[model samples]
Target: MSKRKLRVGLIGGGGIAQAVHIPGWNNLPEAEIVGVADLSEATARKAAAIAGTKEVFTDFHELLKLDLDVVDVCTPNKAHTPAVLAALESGRHVICEKPLAVTTAEVRAMGELADAKELKLMTAQHQRFTQSGVAARAWVDAGKVGEVYHARVRAMRRAWLPPSPGFIDGKLSGGGPCMDIGVHALDLCMWLMDFPTPVRVSGTAKTVFAKGHDMPNLWGEWDRERYSVEDFASGFVHFDNGATMVLEAAWMCHQPDNEELMAQLFGKQGGLAWPEATFSTATNGIFAQGTLTPTTQVPHPHWNEIAAFADCVLNDKLSPVPWTETIKVIGILEAIYASSNTGAEVAVKG
Candidate 1:
């Protein structure tokens, strides 16, 4: 007889669950798409039909009553806490999408629960699965880029605001690009540096173009009065080991050139970059710096994280994106928001 299949319950049948999670999991024979739940019954049914999922529920709480091995959270940021808690409480593994939770406190609570239960609470930071990202981190860990001291991550956009209402809402998204796009950069940097305890964070958030009053996003404008968050944000994070990172992100900026997404790391030996770029190093007498040059592209699928998660869940293997490291990334993110709020250096608490 075949070993037991890992039955999964999916939450949020919108774009992410349909495009990323379901498709990736379907490729794995040991995993089965058992059920799906969403706020919108129509969308949920559409996804369920396409994925060949049998049980569908509009109420996520009801879906939690099923016998599931894994709970894949593709819901909004605010809903992540309750959904994950329910899954972990039910003795089911959890895989939450990025921005793990909207607040550091929420993430800490989830981590605490997962810890007490001795369950794997994996956060899907899909950027970690990219070939370029994989190569960069592996090279750094192998001491190829020795003693990385400084770095820069830039995520630029011409105003491609997401479609979901919760995306622009501060209470839901946590912050603008600093959380959406910048979170990937933060994870890459911290993971490369092995998540050194951050000492300080200084930052600024601007409502330059797409404020709550004027909602002219790249896709289109929503109700202006309902817009309740930032459009662009930038910050500098300082780690306890004296390493620093300059981070920049935005939905809209005044600059003329638009940068896709770039991460650069500099160390004692050499530096590495992705998306057709170069980062070189110099370890000479006194002065040293790095250079950016065009390099051959490293192709990777956007859905690699989902496939990896499926494999891990099916085989009962440990996830690559540990919940603790995800917490560290969220801690820095919380600090950045706090720094923006109080106009003071936010101390990264645990």
Candidate 2:
């Protein structure tokens, strides 16, 4: 740990702020929560209490002027680009939660500004830090999987609604399942396949659940009338490496066995899986489907992802999860929606 702890300014004090950000930041020895902000002063104060800080403000702009080292943004999808850009322009580093931005243009700018300022910028795709995900990626990198050819990523929830008003609005969320949850599976797929350049995409985002049919989710019932995006999405994305991925995602579907999250990597020689890090690889002349094969010399858990972000900020290291990677995912998601709307395959544009 460094002698000087990084002071953090937080924007957004909702459940994600309380449950995810607070606990995640507390685990780091190099970071400190200095100021908290939200749309409501009450919410900000509540988060301050949980974080053991008395500095609470309803305005993030005021908080940003407090000479903070890094700004942690857990706000809605729409606010990501603005908050991050302001933070970077102010000469503060930033760690934003997933879906980097609602659009590729913003993500590019975020990346560009960070580079120009020599500041650390990271997106919180914490699932990348999962023991199974990390282990699986290592296996692929070590050539244990042997010539990867297919990636199947599934993030299907029975009826899980984001529960936030902004989440269902296309203006705020960009899209539905892909931006909300599918990115996790996609990230795992990309990581496992070594981030190959996607050449073409054919996909659809169905409005099966967006109709707001009567359904119950762990997050509770969402008003269908207010629903503005797709409920299910499927894509066939071809990469420059000659490998193709089958991406499937949904917020609510009639599928029998629900998989809220997971990516299955299939290589020419063997297969690997996640949500529980395990693998099946070919050795000598035999192929195994499910076996206890140690992926690498070490294994890491969820907190490890947050630690990576903190490490990057304190050490001034560029994030392994680059904005270019995030922008590509955004481009894919946008293309998927475009393909669905026009009933034609869409090319991913930078």
Per residue, candidate 2 scores C-alpha lDDT tens digits across 56-171 of: 98878889989799898988888888889999999998888888886777888999999999888888887777656666766777776777788888898877768677788777
Per-model TM values vs. the true structure: 0.90, 0.93
On TM-score, the leading prediction is 2
In order, what lDDT does every prediction score? 0.76, 0.80
Q: Model 1 over residues 1-350: C-alpha lDDT tens digits?
A: 87988888998888878887888777667787789999999988988987797788999989888888888898878788988998899988888988888677788898889879877778888777766676666666667677778878777777677756768776666677778887877787777777777778898877777754343456776645555767777778888788898888887776565546777777768877753335565555554444332122434344567667667766668777877788777877778778888999888866
Against the hidden true structure, what lDDT does model 1 obtain?
Answer: 0.76
Question: Residue 336, candidate 1: how far off, in angstroms?
Answer: 1.5
Task: For candidate 1, report its TM-score.
Answer: 0.90
**What is the Å distance of residue 7 in model 2 from its true position?**
0.5
